[model samples]
Target: EKTVVLITGCSSGIGLSLAVRLASDPAKTYKVYATMRNLAKKERLLDCVKGLHKDTLDILQMDVTDQRSVLDARQRVGEKRVDILVCNAGVGLMGPLEAQSLDTMRQILEVNLLGTISTIQAFLPGMKTQGHGRILVTGSLGGLQGLPFNEVYCASKFAVEGVCESLAILLQHFNIHVSLIECGPVNTNFLDNLQAAEPGSSGEQVDARTQSLYEMYLQHCGTVFQNAAQDTDDIVKIYLEAIQSASPAFRYYTNSALLPITSPKTAASDGLQYIKTMSKIIFSTNNKVEQK
Candidate 1:
């Protein structure tokens, strides 16, 4: 028997990698429902799974932000029994506070936070009744420590952290394991997907000092992406451990090199030290030096 895995946002990046990894498992352990928002954009995943057992992988359309879309995908699954659910569908937003719009902020909460909530609500009852299931979410280091220009993105992940934490405790009695994969700078389309500062919003609403801060932050992130980003395959390995563990962990951090940034408790209890330290790290000049 194989686990029925339904993963969201599988068009590319970690979602696509994990779906392929599991579906291609030589042991044939997973039957993956690799879902994306648009069926038209699923060519990459189709190309990857070409030789694999067709019965093991199914590509479906699921826009997490839409209730009808999610439910429709659920209906397509037919059995209503999902052994493993990976809530990986989310978007990113960046830029100074003044340059970000209320709409963009709301959209982040919608897709990242509310989408997770809706997916869990729909599937949890079945897991509760079955007394066995694994719920994994793609969390982030931003969930633990706030980033300068990613206020909205971090806020969404922070909320997800709390949601996953609360559910982990609540679901334990039913033997339903909840795990959060806290990622750091993975090689993904995440940066490109970030809602660019609204047209002219950066120039019009953002002040010179804040705009300077935003540009500096982007440069810092670019350096990190170039040097330290984890590959999608690296992340998929951790995902396998989470899925396969009998005693699964609640939170799994993928990038140990980023511990200093993600471990908030390492900072002074007062939080002032964390603020100062993070600001310095975010605005550091070493990235330019490394580039040169």
Candidate 2:
């Protein structure tokens, strides 16, 4: 029997790739629900998976932010014990905290953190009844380490991290497993669709002080975090393992960095290491070459 796996945010990137690969695996069958907010925007995705076996993939519409939409999807998935649930739907926001309107910040939290909670709650009851299920959430490197402009997005992932940690412990007695996949810099529309606060939505879009600081911070991030720099195959492998393995892990990290830095201890150490490394670099450079 094919494992019934439901995944969100399957319109593109890692979610889309995993759906295609998992459905194509002949050894392990999967009734994969590849969900997206707008199925109309996913014609290419639909075309790409057309060759897979008819039973392998089912495209479903889901908006993690909308309660009605989620409940509707839940109805469609009714009584079918989900073998694995991948909570991958989320948005990114980048700017100074002050530049973001209160409403915008609230929206980010609603979609990323609250939406995840809703999905878990909707599916978890059936999983518990079945006596086994795997829940994997998509977190970010930003969750592990705070980035300059992604304060709200990072906070959302941090919230996810804590929730997943607690859930992993909470669901142990029920034989259900909850895990988090902390990923870094995958090539995705995630960056392009990131929300920005409307300048005039609030009393002001952004005052001069906030706007100047935002631009500076954005510039620094651009210089540090190169676009599409990481190999994503490793991350997908981790996801497949989470879904298939009987003795599944509680957490995994995927990125260009050789060491998977996802744990709270690792995150803190990385921050301290980064500061020490930068200080050394500055001092060494100053000693080697005088400013021109």
Candidate 3:
């Protein structure tokens, strides 16, 4: 009996690679369903699989935010209780937080957070009835640290991290497992998908108020963005391990640079704290000079 695995956001990037890699393993006994928003946009994914020369890959349609879509996906998968679910569907919207529309922020949370919840919920009953399953949620390094200019994105991932940790405890009794992949920047189309809610509008944009708080945050950072990226395959490998391992880890960090450093003498050396302390001294000295 082949293990049925479902993955979302398979049009490109990590999701695509994960689906292809899992499906290609002939001895692994996996029936893979690779889902995307527009099944039409999966040409590259299709091409990648074709190059690998395997036919077990099934392309499906799923939009995680919609309960109906999730139900429909369940029906399509049919009879096969999903053995593993990779909640990989997510979007990125970048700009000054003040400029980000309310709808945009909601969209991010909806697709990244609620979407994962819905996907898990949709498949949970089946997995529980079967007495086992693996749930993998794609978290981010941004969730671990407060990165600059990406307030909303970071918030959503942070929420995911929190939720998944709690979920792991909850699912323990059912023999089901939940894992989170706290990844760093992987080379993906996430950077290209960013958009401003309104190019030019006098009226209210959806996320205006949240965007306002975000703008204030950027003013302190002095830089718009940072490039801490690795190849997408590196993260996909972690996802695969979480699925295939007999005893999978609860959390896996893809990029080593982003991992927390703790020495026996002093684990309190947070670089961010040191920078903040210096910033306070510099500002305080400037204030005294102005008074003189």
Q: Which candidate leads the pack in lDDT?
A: 1
Tens digits of per-residue lDDT, candidate 1, 95-127, equal 877777677789899999999999888789989
Tens digits of lDDT, candidate 3, 1-292 = 7888999989888898888888887585788889988888888887877755354678889989989988888889854689999998888656555556677889899998899889988999999999999998888766765554577887888888888888899899888889988876677777677444454332445467556545554443322225456777888788877777998889888877656322321425555563453334323435456545
Query: Clash pairs of candidate 2?
Result: 199-205
Q: Itemize residue pairs with steric clashes in candidate 1.
A: none
Winner by TM-score: 1
What TM-scores do the predictions have? 0.94, 0.84, 0.80
Instruction: Please report, in order, the local distance difference test score of every candidate based on alpha carbons.
Output: 0.87, 0.77, 0.76
Minimum summed lDDT over a 10-residue window in model 3 is located at 260-269
Pitting candidate 2 against candidate 3, the one with the higher TM-score is 2
Q: Which stretches of candidate 2 lie over 4 Å from their true place?
A: 198-201, 204-213, 256-292
lDDT of 1: 0.87
Model 2, 15-95: lDDT tens digits are 887777777777657888888899886776677677764778777899998888887887786436788899998898986
